[model samples]
Target chain A: MVSILGVGLGVAALLVVQTVMNGFGEEHRLRIRESFGDCVVIAKSPIEGPDVLIARLKADPEVISASAYTEGPALARRGAFSGVAFVRGTDPLATDQPVRQYVVAGSFDGLDDGRVILGIGLARTLRVAVGDKIEVWSPVMAEQAEKGKAPLPASLEVCAIVRTGFTEVDDRAAIIPLRRFRELWSLGERAHGVTLRLKDPANAVATAARLNVGKAGLNFIPWQEIKKNFLEAIRFEKTMLFFLMFIITLVASFSIGSTLFSAVIRRTREVGVLVALGAQRWHLVGLFGVQGLLIGALGTALGFLLTWGILYFREGILDLINSLFGNGDMVANVYQFSKVPLHYDAMDFVVAAAFTLIVTTVAGLVPALWAAGRKPSEAMRDA
Target chain B: MPKVVLQATGLKKSFASPNGPLAVLRAVDLVVHAGESISIRGSSGSGKTTLLQLLGGLETPEGGEVFINQVEQGLVTPRKLLGHGVGFVFQNYQLMPELTALENVVLAAKIIGRSQVEGKARELLQLVGLGDRLRHLPSQLSGGECQRVAIARALINEPAVILADEPTGNLDETTGKEVMKLLLEVVAQRQTALVLVTHSREFAEKASRRLVLAGGVLSSA
Candidate 1:
């Protein structure tokens, strides 16, 4: 029973931790895809006709949607608040669907002349709201005209406030018309890149490989490849947690060995009887080994069931916990989301089960050997 | 010449005790011919049990050689020798409490690579008057019945030699005699060599050859 608990707890912890880790990675990747599309295509030199390339890519069945965008640093000043932000210039009609789907408030429109969209977080910090007038300055535009001069100022109206709920993107970002941004930056109808959405998010890599834009002179980057560091970190953390929790299972198996050893010592005569009846050492080994395996398997199964139960009602449980503790910021702290988002990975469950079985089998070794190594005469003498 | 089934020469054994190295057996020599039932009688401290242990390969002797079926004891690994065919029956009837009498006997046959283990175990159990109690475990059986199961287990592999150490010591006199009778009857059917250790003179007298251990030597009687 104790051995079962040990193995079960180990499997349970490994699965839970791995599932959460995978969920975290998947959630982040999804957000990146939704915000940046499945892949981004950038030109070696500013492509001459990016619209033509977009039309060609859109003709491909693999490509779901494509939109041209430009990005650069800009300073927005309003009263006492002045902060630098990444100003992304995107077409309100072409790029708004995939990128602005996560926008919690305000619509993406009104880009007729000097209108812009500001992230809610950035707007709050700048103490500005929709319809508020703000000054936009770019050093690149200033440098083009004369060196060491203050940036060229462009008076812009805050057309909308978009809340993406991502600190990295929402804290300091704004969107505007790609044409207006091109004119301001003096780029002359050139775009920084085009973001491509795929029919299947999982097929992003294959689709990236199939993207043949030889004449377009563009290089494509899959969203997964772009976030390789983050993905690797998540996988590494999950692996570390798996082994770390497996130690508990190993310790529990030791308890099983101890218990079996004691049982052998107490049942010396019984062992002698088997030996006397022509039972080989292997037979004794197998008998006790099977016992240990059963203990481990049972424990692992129980733990899996318990883990499933916990994961099944995780929302209610968390809510109950919140009711008691008065929710502070666990979701934001742990998952960087407003609530816990979980994904149950079957592969993680298999890994946990396999690891538990191995540990249990290994733990059975000492006891099995002890029982097998005893001489029938010695064992029977105890009778 | 008679076929020799078991032979031991100049056997010696000693164990470390708190006081000193206690000599259990010294220079013990014995032999048993095929199809012969020999009874070895000795007092409790006369190394009767130690000598039996060495003969059964349960303990290594300090000095001596043991041969079963003319195979050099040292040349054969103890485990392999046991698998080949060595049967032991303890006085206390050491049956596995978890296994039924039928399972206990069948397991022995299976380990020794005997085909039709279930059939053989059933036949042996019935011969020992345990046909009705085949499904009973050691815990469920009487002391005498448990001993009978142990006897059935010992014969499961059709071993060449049968060694019993005080086979009837744990039973009442009547039950002890009955067990002895059944043992002799089974051995006679197999025509195997039998070596029994007993304190009862009556039991010893039943054997074709009887040896009494005294003064560190077996004297024929």
Candidate 2:
């Protein structure tokens, strides 16, 4: 029973951690897709005839929508407060504008050449709200000033506020009309890039690769490539955790081996009797092997039941732990999630069960071999 | 004139001791026919048990061969020798403690790949006067009862010869007498050969042929 419980607890711990990690990964992916779309095509210089490129891209079967955009770093000042911000210029009237749904205050439709949308963190930093005026200077204006050609900073009204729930974007992003960006940068009828939303975001990498062919001076990047390091880190952590949790099952297997070894020693005489009664050596080995398999099967079954129970009562269990530790609302405060997330993948269960069963069965083989190695006469005389 | 059921020729066995190799059985020869009972008496440590083990093929003799039912024991597998050729009853009644009396008896049949022997096992238990204790485990049964279960287990496969090594050694006087009587009666009824090894003169005298083993040799008692 103890061995079974040990294996059960180990499996439950591994599965729970894996499921929660998957949930975090999924949530992060969703937020990233919301902010960056499925794929982005970037150019070294402003793209010429962007409308033609957008039309060509939209003609592809995989492309759901494509819109021209311009983005760069800028300095923003509001009264006595000032900060550096990433400025993105987009077509406000585009049907697939991703930031439109994230607008928390005011209206994205009001954005024009003289107005802009501020990310929630930037709005908080600047202490500004709707209808407030903010001064912004492009990097070109800074370069002109360095060359002794003084240029005035553009003054735009804050028409909306957006909170995309992605810390990197929400912290220091500002969106303005595309015409406003081109006018400020002294560019004519050009855009920095075009963002594409595909029919299946999971196919972004393949779509980006296909679209990059024959398109000179434009680099197509998928969301996965954009966040490769973060995703890989999550996967590495999950793998490490799986092996670490398997140690518990390994210890339990050792317990099973120990118990069977003791049984062999205790029943030395009985073993002799069985051998005298015509039992082959392999029969003794099989007896102990079957015992190990039974333990593994029962333990794995109990582990699955434990996993279901833990996931079902996850909220209450978290609440109890938090209350005991005096860390109320830990998930919300640390993870920015209102509740713990769990994602069930069938592969995780299968791998856990297979690993446990194989380890336990192999563990039993040691004692079984020892038992079968004894001579019947030696066993009887010794006992 | 009866058919020869078991034969051992020039049997020899030795053990390695701290001083030197000690010879146990030296040039021992024996033969027994069907429906015959032979008892070999010896002092403690006289290699009586060693001789029985060698004849039953439980121990490999260094310089002799055992034949059961006209087949040399060395030529065939030990499983065949112990399964269909001979049966063993140990001094301590070596029954599996976890198994019931009936299951222990049936286990011998199972070793020979005989599956449909539960009814025969029950009948053997009843013949040994253990019908009421068929469901009792080894730990629950008394010394004599455990010996009876062992005897029943030995006869389950109906081998041609039964090699009993002090089957009543652990029981009291009255229980030992009862167990010996039951063993002899059952072996006689089945017409199976029996090779009995004991230290008791009374039991040895009851066999058809009585012999005494000493100085690693067997002589008429």
Candidate 3:
């Protein structure tokens, strides 16, 4: 019975770990899908050309919103404070995606002017915030201006503070306007690229297909495709984890096998009796295997029920913890949500339960065969 | 005169040992008739058990064929023959410890496709005087009581023949006699051939036909 408990625990732990790994990967994918629309159409040509192309896209019914963006690697400096940064220039009115919802201070309307929006981390590194003046310098722009002599100085003021939790984007990037970016880059009639928000993300393939310009000198790649490498890695890891965890249940199966073997050895006389009484070899095998099946079914059912029950009350438990801590917003900062985000998938439960049953049944083999192999007289002789 | 129920001719069996091939049964011939109780007696290691196994079709003979109920034992696999017509009772009271006495009997009845398994299981248990202990597991029963359950299991199928390899070998002398009495009574009631293998002269003498097996063959004495 204790061994059953241990086996159950081993199976449950493997299932839970697999589930969490799946959840983590799914969480990231969903964040990306929700953050960036299914695709971002980037042009290698000048920024203004893409801005003009975006206008045509915005008029299309399938296009939700098409916004031009100017992004480049540069240095953000304020007095002696200098930190390297990547600046993304967007039409604020057109590019107010939910990812930009974390604007902390100042007006998003200031992007039309020379004022820039800075991420909290970038603002902290440069020691500046909304209403603070900062110099934006790009080496490409600096080198181009020097060729013409009398470099263009675009001294900008930070007007909005945005806090996106993603460290990759939030800690290193700032946002400006499309026109100001073209001015900074000394490009004529060209915007860097157009980011399109589609009516339905799943229609990204169709949308990219419709936007295909055979000789247009630009690529419209879906966000999913761009991040396919990351998604594929996660998928591979999940497969590896599944097999690795199955090994735990396999070990538990060895226990079943050993238990059945001992049962067969001790019950040799009883088996002989059954054989004498007209029991077939397969019948004896089935009988012992059925016992194994019962144990596995009972243990798996109990473990899954326990797991589901815990998951069911998990929200209440979190609330209790939050109330005990006397902080209503405690969970928000820790898990980035007010509630524990647990998604229950029926497919996940079925796969896990079925897998456990197979493992347990395989464990019953050795002992069943041992019992069936005994000759009635040979077993009876021992008695 | 009874009709022959089991026949084996020149049956031979051997086992691989460190020394050489140890012949357990060598060129043996046996015949058992329906409604007749035959006792095979032999000293230990004298091939008495081997002869019984060969006659019962429980083990395949190295060189010859065993026939049960006019069906060639080799033609019908051992498992099929055992399930359909052969009823065996081991000396150890080989009752399944996990199953109740009722379940043990019901299992044999179920195996042979008998009708009214519950009624038959109950009737057999009653025949062995274990009707009250129907639900008792083998572990809960005494040595004699377990043997009674084994007897009940054997008769549940109404087999064409019954094979008992020292059915009372583990019981006290009195208990053994009582068990033998119950076994003979049940076999008589079912009209099944009874083959009893034992070293006990008391059991051997009770059989309608007594044979002693030595040097790999049986001869009536």
| Share of reference contacts kept by candidate 3 | 0.67
Instruction: Please write out the lDDT profile of model 2 over residues B119-151, one tens digit for every residue.
Output: 999999999999899999999999999999999
lDDT tens per residue, model 1, A1-383: 76677667767776777677677777887887877779888867766667888898889898888888888888888888988878888887764455455455556656545888888778888899888978878766668658655555888888877755567677778888888888777778778988888888798887887795464467888888877887788778877877887776667777887877786787777777567555778888888878877877898798898788777887777878877998756766444575566788887778777767776766676778887888777777775
What TM value does model 1 have?
0.84
- Deviating ranges (above 4 Å) for candidate 3: A1-18, A30-37, A47-52, A102-114, A129-131, A138-157, A163-168, A179-190, A213-215, A246-263, A288-359, A366-371, A379-383, B15-19, B70-79
Better DockQ candidate (1, 3): 3
Where's the lowest-lDDT run of ten residues in candidate 3 chain A?
Answer: A334-343
- lDDT of the structure predicted as candidate 3: 0.75
- Compute the lDDT of residue A138 as modeled in candidate 3: 78
Give the better candidate number (2 or 3) by TM-score: 2
What C-alpha lDDT does candidate 2 achieve relative to the native structure?
0.87
Query: What tens digits encode model 2's per-residue C-alpha lDDT throughout A58-166?
Result: 9999999999888888999998999888999888888877788778899999999899899988998899999999999899999899999989999999999988766
What tens digits encode model 3's per-residue C-alpha lDDT throughout A144-212?
767996665568899888765556666887888766776777656566677777787777877787876
Q: State, as a TM-score between 0 and 1, how close model 3 is to the true structure.
A: 0.82
lDDT of 3 at B200: 90
Model 1 regions more than 4 Å off:
A41-49, A56-62, A109-115, A128-160, A180-188, A199-232, A246-249, A252-267, A292-307, A320-329, A332-339, A342-351, B18-20, B70-86, B181-192
